[model samples]
Target: MNNILTLAAIYRQSLFYFAIRAMTILEPQTKLSRNWHQKAIAYQLMQCFLGLCRRLIINQPPKTLKTHLVSISYVAWLLMHDPSLRIAIICYDEALASTQLRKIRQLLRSKWYMALAPATRIRKDKDTETLFETTAGGEVRALSVQGGITGHGFDVIIIDDPQKASLAHSETERRHLEELYASAIANRWRNPAKGVLIVVMQRLHVDDFTAYLLRLRKDTVHLNIPAVAPVDMTFHLDDDEVYRFREGELLEPERLSDVVLEELRTAQGEVHFQAQYMQAPVKTGGCPINPAWFRTYTELPKYDYRIISIDPAFTENGGDFSAALVCDVVGDDVYLVHGEQVQCDYPNLLRWIETLDKTWKPDLFLIEAIGAGKGIWGLLRERDFHHVGTIETHNGLPKLRRMEIVSPMIEAGRVFVPANAEWARQFLRLIGSFPYGPSDDWPDALSQLLIRLRDACMRAGQHRCRRFPPDPPPQQTSLRYGMHYRKYWL
Candidate 1:
């Protein structure tokens, strides 16, 4: 009897030990496997329950027992210590939330749990799948991100897998969850000072809920554990305990072997694999141009030709920015000298264009024919601006496809940008984030310049510039003539 009591005392003290024992009782069919990552996660969760960390975010690979450790065992452990604690477990959907709640209830109701923490009994009148209460007034509510929690409040909120991987690409779905967090979920804490908010999930998008929360809360305690270690580092779990991870080490070699990881990588593709397993999400639809591919220049080199490319937006407010890039073509390389993106009306946009032209003194001006581009082109011509031309895109080619066509030049170190320019930083960010980013105006304008430059070089019989064959010429009738009898078509 004394030995059993001692074991129960130990279980109540250490969450990690309690998790091992509880998981055995809950899942008797599967053999329990131990890993240090589990201990690391439990330690952080314990910190949250103790009020050491108010906001916590844990980003890890999928199916590594994140939900089991965080949603089930942690909730039950918290109740064991204080049955009056009100907790909420939230998931992407009601089904997931209910599933987690059921597991917690099972663990609480087990004979082993009854022996260890008999005081944390479920109230007979308040037992349900989605919500239940203890005899001491402790409440556990299960909810989906789409559900409402207006009338109730929680002392501890656990958001587990609040985003579905398949729907991560849908902007509407991502925005809806973000809006819910900002407006509803963030304000539902019972005690603002003592409440805890914990988020645990695999990364799905660059702008997913995890990213959104981190941006809003700079003091959030982030525990990022990838399936495979990208570098050798030491994680200080506690004052005396530290987990040292070596480079290229598998997070759990027993379950997720190198062979299995390879298979998953092949099945999920590079973009999904990097996001889900590595916990480093890139741009959606696979970023065509890698940011590291572009060469950097501190000063402009001697250039033979210079042109300005513009991608204009129709609206002056609450829409895409009117973007322009001034590029210099020196021999076979293209140097991005200056760039700007602003939200303004047509008159201001025209003035901005005139300013760029006069400052740079470019040999040609290539403006996209869509949106406000035609208006800008006609007005520039009326103003007698030299070497003005409108770029006509092929009907069948999409923006993504056009970017893919010009990516080789960037990858070959033929594209250059200022090393320390603020505008260059913004330009690279938009280019790197591409379709997944908020705006594509910068990339669109840059792609127009590269495509046109490539075509011109091909026409001049530059063998080194023939990375891709030029698109068949557009019909002469479809061509838009410019001043000085010059021809312009893309």
Candidate 2:
């Protein structure tokens, strides 16, 4: 939040001094670690500042293109030679990766490394086709990320910015990256000493694969240098930029952003671009609801009232989780109470619901009608679901209408949600994407249930007279009555 213009001016005043300050952090050894050559870009950027730490004063010329290419080529070569070493050279886009690959080819083609060059044409390997080897017995391969190609047991995993299907501000793509870490990419390291993994990319995310490595790996390294870092510090932020929605945008901010950001509809416009460039906190801008609202309004006593809401996806291949959440409502806050799930069709799912009705003793039961909603409602009616029964059964609220009402309540501090439940976490991820993907199915159900409850309160005044109370049991006739038909006939 510093005055960016002033910081820029100060940066201009002593960029050399700042670079000197940056270099002072890393102490150099007469001989650097051999494997250090293979560290990622951000780690290399950190080295420029480390030189400042030296007791003797020494100045080096400004870094050049050759310096960067040489560092990259040096690392690429080691990664290729090292067996089971996983290397990722991710660029901002496929074009960037391809361009970097060409750079690698150039390095290999260089006469200096003639000893390592292949003897003849290298054969491409795929689908048990005739095996091809590098001229020097090495292997070179490339795959377009958009092709959705996957390789296993990779001696070296060279990925240059393997970005596809709309990079930058895509939460879906980000989620895919997380899954790749948990299921696909991380699974590659099946052995204890399987391989060394390296990721080279700009700081696109704080939760990216790179960030994941930064947190988990002991040998992780990073290098991040903006185009204007040498001459300016608040180098990215400028006056025209008002809202930020991406990393690049957050890097630069105008002096008056605080005053301006408080009042703008940048939601549909350049908000995404600015966020990327400036690196503004995505948590604040992208969240559908504010934490303060939940904090202030949340007064639910621990595990109080049970709330049961369901999500019903029509088909299995739809790639969705048909979920149910049981929430406990206390004074004003909410807690996850219980959950029910079924993967099959209507009859079984209905039986599952009936069992839940019996077990949880839910005060109210909400069933989502997005897919087989009508049939489900009919089945429940046929099963003799009574309003006064142990648990009341109600139709689900419309998903869109529900979101419209509940979203603001969430933002205004009138709603509270538990964070511990698997359902809640899933709900948050889907809500973060809003109407973007299939995962939204679960949150849609919860939102609809709450909205229907609100509408029920509105109809309270008109309900009493029109509401047909459950019929009274048939009256008993006494033999003493005038007719006395039962006794006389006997």
Candidate 3:
């Protein structure tokens, strides 16, 4: 009886202990892999259960037992401590939610768990695959982000991977999730002030649901544990305990060795690996346009040709800004001499364009013939800027494809940016972040300039400069270079 009581005491005190025992009960044949990262996760979950932290966000790599620690063991442990505490488990889909809830139900029904939490008995009358209630009024419910929880309320809400990784790029899906949280899920808390909300998932996109929550709530305790440590760091687990990881250290080297991680990185592109494994969606290491590929120039060389490219926003009050880049092409090398983005009205935009044209005295001015570009083109033409031309629409290629077309120029060590300019730093960041980054105006302008340069070189019968992929087949519209400019076709 004394040993039984001591075991119970240890289980109650340490979530790590409880988890290990529960894992044994759940997977009797499988051997357990012990790691400090697991202990760190368990500690954070314990803090959430104890109400020490009401809002918790856990971002980690896949297959790290995030679901086991958070959705399964944590739910069972919560019921053990307080039989009357209501809980809800949310997942990306209904099937996933049901599976997680079923696991928790299995734990609650296990003989080992019964011996530990004698008071928490599952009520047979209300038992289902997705939901089950304890006799003491405590209930566990499974919900999906798409499913309705109109009348349901819970003391604790655990959302596991609210969005699927495949659908992470869909702005519509992302917006729907944000709206759902604001309108529904957030308000379902039984106790507004006391209810705990825990979100656990791998990072998918720069503006994913995790990012949304972080932006919305200031007090959220974000525990971002990357698969490999990017730098040496120390984590305070408790007053007496701290876990330290050296730079380039694996989170769990035994389970996920350096060899395995490299294979995964190769199989999955750098962008996916960085977001899912490193928890860095917009890091330059993941981007197709690598920062290392760009050569920085301190002194300008005599340029054979100079041109200014512009990507304009529709309105001053809009999210996007009017971006312009002054690019100088000397033989095979394209140098980014100057770049700027600003939120301004048409008059201001026109003035900015005129200023850039006057300052650079480029041979040609290329403006994307969309939104504010059309107005800017008309205004520039009226101002007697004869060198100006509009970049023809109807390319049928997306922004990403356009960037990909010009990436070869950058990778070939032919692209240059000013070494010490502040705008250059911002330009590199914008391009490096690419499709995941907040703004693609700079990338757009840069790609346009590169495309134009490539097309001009090809037209001039310079086969050496034809390194990039051929332009897409021409559409219905073909116009003169100075009037309504279109990409030159062979």
What's the TM-score of each model vs. the native?
Answer: 0.60, 0.33, 0.61
Q: After superposition, which runs of candidate 1 have C-alpha atoms over 4 Å from their true positions?
A: 285-490
Q: Write the per-residue lDDT of candidate 1 for residues 1-490, one digit (tens) a residue.
A: 9999899998998888898998888888877799888889888988887778999999999889899899999999999999999999889888999999999999999999887887899999998889999999999999987676543779999999998776676667789998898888888988888889999999988888889999998989999998899998677666589999999999999889999998777545566788899999987466788898889999898875678898987667788898889988776788999998889887788888889977988767899776678777888877877477776774546787578667767776789999999999988888999868989999999888888877766665654442333343433222233222212222
Q: Report the lDDT tens digits of candidate 3 across residue range 1-490.
A: 9998999899988888888888898888978888887888888887887678999999999999899889988888888999998998888798999998888888988888888889999999999887888999989989888886543679999999999886675677889999988998899888898989999999988889999999998999999999899998776576578899888999988877999998776545567778899998873323567878899999999885677899987568868988988887776788899998999887788888878877887767899777778878888877777667777652456677567556767776788999999999988888878889989999999888877777767665764442333454343122223322222321
For 350-371, candidate 2 gives per-residue lDDT tens digits of 7777777777765545665435
Q: After superposition on all CA atoms, what RMSD does each candidate show versus the true structure?
A: 13.3, 20.7, 11.7
Candidate 1 Cα RMSD after full superposition onto the native fold (Å): 13.3
- Sort every candidate by TM-score, greatest first: 3, 1, 2
Q: Considering TM-score, which of the candidate structures 2 and 3 is the better prediction for this target?
A: 3
How far in Å is the alpha carbon of 446 misplaced in model 3?
22
Q: Provide the clash count, candidate 3.
A: 0
lDDT of 3: 0.81
TM-score for candidate 3 = 0.61
Worst 10 residues of 3 by lDDT: 476-485
Off by over 4 Å in 3: 283-490
Error of 3 at 160 (Å): 0.4
